[model samples]
Target: MNQDSKNKERHQGRSFTNETLFLKDLVGFQRIKYRYVNVLGMLAGLLIVVQAWALSNLFAGLVSFNTLSFFMLILGLLAWLLRSVLHLIRDLIASEASRNIRFNLRKKLLSELTFLGPKRSVIDEDAALSTRVYEQVDALDDYYSRYKPQTFMVTVVPFIILLTVLPISLITFFIFLLTAPLVIFFMVLVGHKAANANRKQFSVLAMLSNQFMDMNQGLSELRRLSRVKDARERLSSSAKAYQSTSMGVLRLAFLSTATLELFASLSIAMVALYLGLGLLEKLPWQLGSSPVTLTNAFFLLLLAPEFYLPLRQLGQDYHAKQKAEAAASGILQILEASTSDSSTTQVHLKDSETPQTLMLFDSLSLDANKRTRLVSISGHIHEGERIWLSGESGVGKSSLLYILLGFEDSYRGQCLIDGIDIKQADLSQWRSRLAWIPQSPEWINGTIRQNLTLGLSNLDSASIHDALEKSKANIFIKKLPNGLDTKLSELGTGLSGGQMQRLSIARALLSNADVWLLDEPCASLDQETAEAVLETINRVSEQKTLLVVSHDTHPIEWVDKHWKLTKEGLYEVA
Candidate 1:
């Protein structure tokens, strides 16, 4: 008896909440909100009557041989029909409620995630994140729609069965009541241990799946390092761990199943034992010969075994609950992280034109890593002037470009644009108003035209070609088989380093922003080509607010002002 009670306590309290995991635990959430759960509760109460009526009549042999038996069956069909329709309706409502709950919760979690992204939560490998979002979260659908309602049905069914039986026969009723707690006791105790095992297996599976996804993403890197065989071995180990744990769960589950059946059979056999003796006149009442009259004992006999059927099911569902618990814990961690970040700091972006200014530093410092710092910094430029920042080797020249680009996390003072703070404004919108082309900008698999027309509608292709012609990019595109529409493969097979840079400049020129932040605008070019590119930069910077971070010491001399970054700080040199 104590053992039965112990099992009951194991599944007593499993919680799933927090914005992330809440969506995954929709099954539990729906039961709490089910307005019709009470109505379903009443149906569960009526089920005892339905079972008694159906089983009693079936045993009574009211439908004797031939047409006489058939007549009795047709006449008694109404009672069976009531039972069928009620169960059907109850099941349908539970299914619908579960579906609604799961969908709404999933949608809510996704929306919250959107509000906190790009920097809030990063997916190192998006494939795993996406799989968890769709697949792992999908594991809850059946649980919500089926197992959740079943949980309630399981809880209410046994007691209702006991309640109906007690009035008809207290002796048999107390016995049913007494042994049920014992079976349930074993179920809870063993089921708790099984749930824990299932939890561990599920975690390992999710981890394994995520790791394999990452392995696939970095397949190229792995291949280069000749580590593909090692990666596969690791995956195999994870799979084995999952399988071993799952088998352990299955073993516990079989024990649970056998235990539920054992106690249930024992209880029903007692009822049968009691009734079999009653036939020999052990009790005061005599056994009826009429099918309906004697049918009572038969239905009672059938119901004994039926009462434990769901409890038998408890083992498998306890595992499902275990899976839900695992998924819930993982998702909750994500929600807590997002919530904490949101509560701790209100992130106002860098483009809001607040009182704080967003001007360029006189000189910005740079270095590769540890030894990198400011060496040459020159003074500021007004709204319309085009300034060029230049320096020698190992200088903080490129670092100056990062400072203006807003990638650097730390800077000595504020950069103000017209007395407005750069940090508060939308950097995206601000970037939209300017063109930036780094020395070696990355490219995707696309044509030169696609790179230029990216995110822009109604762009003039003629202007695109003109910008390309200026950067000498048009020369390479024209040489391709498809000309401007050539498909650049993933690894950039068709274009040279110089050609890629030229296309980047063309993209920048197409943007036509107020300010052009050009870092090493004419790098990695032959002497003659570098001269032409510099000529184009001088022409383009005339009306634009250009801040050129360059390593060139050419003769043209068109820079209106020069800022040098030194150890002292940024100051104007020309």
Candidate 2:
């Protein structure tokens, strides 16, 4: 095959895989609830047949015998009410199932993100990730609540109607069987195109969302650079692209609905024609007489539309299935990326009464893009040692800290703590023993107390005050209105860089972990502030093992030893 054919084949394969994954998740998440939805659907189908039979009998009694049967009328009304009730029940069950599925899916996505941590950059764009977690997950609501149950109804309800029709008129049954395929044929033909269109629409939506988020986050920079107009124009272009693709999907949906309706109408019309002719004794046959009675004719005519109801509904819901498949593709990619490496051992790292020692035996790290981040280098940090590690820009100084913090594990060689290789140890337990203070600290839009005591319970007032004083953040924090109870904006927007850094240090101090991994902790501070922060860190971390990666020489005097990292290897600076 040529290149175009090969590409088409690959695309088709990917679509199929996405569809399979969606089905697996649907069944796996709420198998019992989904089964109940189908059971209700089947019961409703029987009720539909009963309602049609009663209505047909009621009409036949009035037309043929010139007499009204109140019994038939009551039976028909009761069946109709029961069928409606069944439908309502099915919808309620499906809706609950859909909500539960979305909840579990979001939880899994969040867990994966938490597990990956900094390595979640492999997911490409943060905006795209948010879209998957929110928008894409919401798109599956209709698939689970409507399309899934409808699929079962289309299969079971039509068969029940067929069995009812077979005894009344063979010709109607044959027409039902044969004409059903045409509707399905057109549905499949249109649906293939709709599926591709939905996927494209979702892709464009993700790109547009990512671009909009990026622009929004950097609006100040755009204005300062005099590129606000350019950003606006680019955003407008993406919006137009998304609009075009969305219109394409809507067009395919309309076309599929119309096609199914045309075929369904023609088939129902044919059924009506046959029933009318037989009732008038006009059907072409050797006997030249109607084989179907007046009551049976009424029954067949009343049941004709019911036969295609499921098929029509299925066509309408096919678009939802397509949307869900597209969304599942993105979600599954993230979940799969999280579990791709399950070979890592789960041995829990037990906390030792003695101080812990960290050893690196030629540890190396490769980034998500397969680029060498940390070269083959080996070193050891004894307990209670405050080592200052200096390296040039892009020399993997932060990468080394990430490896020790249990965030980046795509490395060769061993990172051992107390003779236990970290790769083989439980990351959750290992991380619980380490305190990490990144160069750019992050805080949620919550009270300062919440940010400081995150995940650390039972921190009394004295402990909080002690931690803040030790990090030199108490003076600034005390001046703020409401003190620690004062709320801060996202990323600590109300505070200066130095204050945020100090608060981060205080938060780390509150963790009371045995090891401290400080990645350029003072990089954002001035000379005086940096010196103060380093001095505070040295005093507080006197009994803890500290590995501080910085380019400044302020920590050189206080640190036990200074190590310099180069492309060649890690070396001690005498």
Candidate 3:
């Protein structure tokens, strides 16, 4: 079998780690917050017994028509109220804990993503990664809040109820004990199936989400190529698969609930029958020394259902166990993908300390998707040099940039900075000394000043205005009512394409990096705007090293070197 098929088989098999143990490992149960949540839950379970005992006494008093019946009823109501309060507190604690855990998981996931950089190629689609990181991580809420604490309750609560029942009648206690295992056994059997189904369901959900995002993004291109129908059909297929798997999961959950209900009802009924017989003195032989009093009978009857309540709840939450397991599987998979391979050696450095001097790319090569994109490419990018690199659309221009940023590890040959191997340098420190401007710049929904000065702190207005002016972005900023303080929608939607590019250029310039990398900097802009941006870039390149990757042949009088990347290698242009 192929690797993917084997992976699927393993994922669907009955080989998962213990769900509770996995959660505990991720966020230790020894944490003070989680301990508080569990303690509250345990207290709530103990309250069930108090509530049931009070209700039983009230019932017995009403049957006897005693004057104390009113007081007993009031006590029962108070016990019920206290139980509700405990439950509410436990729920609030669980919610707070779940929120904290989700926050931590998201932070950890983002850190790993930053470490892996942009070229990890694990999920291939941003939508799929987002779904896993956002939705799948959030799905862990019920597992930690409900399923985990519930598991503890299932273990402790029933035994506590059993202790209360044993003193009244050992016969009733034994009957409860014998039938309890049947409910749990069936639950485990069905839960195993539910877990497998949930794993496949989540996989399909991710697949469908990725397809929908890709279709939406490439709709224009698909329509232009007359393949819109094909794209739509594939998306529909994935969506249908996800829907079918989801329904199957629901059916299993319902079936498990029904089966547990049947077993628990039977167990309760058996206990009730035994208690009633003992009260009527209908048993052939004695099971306990004390006769079954009216008070004891009612208590046992009330406590029987309470004994099974925790188990019943656990059965209901079996689906959550499955969901959490599936989410954990996806999360662990991403974490494993972030592990550094042997090909790249990481060296630690003090913050912001980067190597200086010209970087040499010697006999560099990379193969992706069975196609050789770069072959024996060799070149030098000296400090304080203005270089323009031109390449055809599919000649791996962006891939080379990724290499310099230490984002792509699956490549051969040496990238040297000051005669030290790039692999041995600290990537974070190296990145801190470089600035990148992509073909499409990303913008958050924030003020223009916030977008420009994202990573840096404490920039005076004069410096901000200076960078903006140099990039030619001040032209439009002056027209705006708020200028630098103006709020922008996502991706700077209110701004023209050229305006956004200039703002990105301004942001890059503000970084004050020694080396600047530009990927198709003026792509999709008008000739006038492109020329203006190029002129700004040319003026900035006088001091800093510049690596400009573009298809534009606009004259750059300030550039010192020019190269064109072809199938064989990079060639210096005459």
Best by lDDT: 2
Per-residue accuracy of model 2 over 1-574 as CA lDDT, tens digit each: 4333322322222233555565554556588988998898888888888888888888888887888889889988998898889899999999998999889778867766776676676676878888889998998998989998898999998899999888878999999999998888888889889888988988898899989988987888899999999999999999999999999999999999999999999999998888788777787782468878888888888788888989999999888888888888887777655432344545756556775566555555445466767778888887888898998888789888777766666677887877787666766677888888888776777999999998899899999999999989999988997999999876576788888888988998899887888888878788898887777787888888888998954555878899999888889998
lDDT of 3 by residue, 1-574 (tens): 4333322322331233554555666564336766776687667767777777777787787777664666667777887788788778877777777788888777767666665566645445667787889989998988878887788788878878888778877788788889899999999999999989988988898888888877876777899999999998998899889899999999999999999999999888887777777777776686543367788788888888878888999999978988898888887766555323433445543332343456889898888778887777888876777788887887878888888887676778987766667666766668877898988776778999999999888788899999998888999999999988999965575688889988988888888887899889888788898888888788765678889998845655568888888887899887
| Model 2: lowest-lDDT 10 consecutive positions | 6-15
Q: Would you estimate the TM-scores of all the predictions?
A: 0.62, 0.90, 0.78
Looking at model 1, report the run of 10 residues with the lowest lDDT sum. 338-347
| Candidate 1 structure quality by residue, lDDT tens digits, 1-574 | 2322322322222234442345444445565545475466457556656756665665577433222345435434654576567667766776777667656656655644543333222432344455455555665655655566566667777777887777677777888778878877887887778767866765777777778776775677899999999998988998898899889978887877787778778887888887666645565454542212256677677677667766666645655665565565555544443321111222233433333323645333444346756553535566557777766755666655555554442444555444444433344455677777776565667876676788777787688877887767777788888988888754456576567667777777787776788777667677776677777677655766778887655534787777754455655665
Residue 335 displacement (Å), model 2? 1.3
Please give the lDDT score at residue 160 for candidate 2. 95
RMSD of 2: 6.5
**Global lDDT of each model?**
0.62, 0.81, 0.78
Q: What is the lDDT of residue 417 in candidate 2?
A: 74
Better of 1 and 3 by TM-score: 3
What TM-score number comes out for model 1?
Answer: 0.62
Which segments of candidate 2 are over 4 A away from where they belong? 1-19, 284-287, 339-346, 350-356, 367-370, 392-395, 525-528, 551-557
Candidate 1: regions farther than 4 A off: 1-48, 61-125, 221-225, 246-255, 281-293, 339-356, 359-574
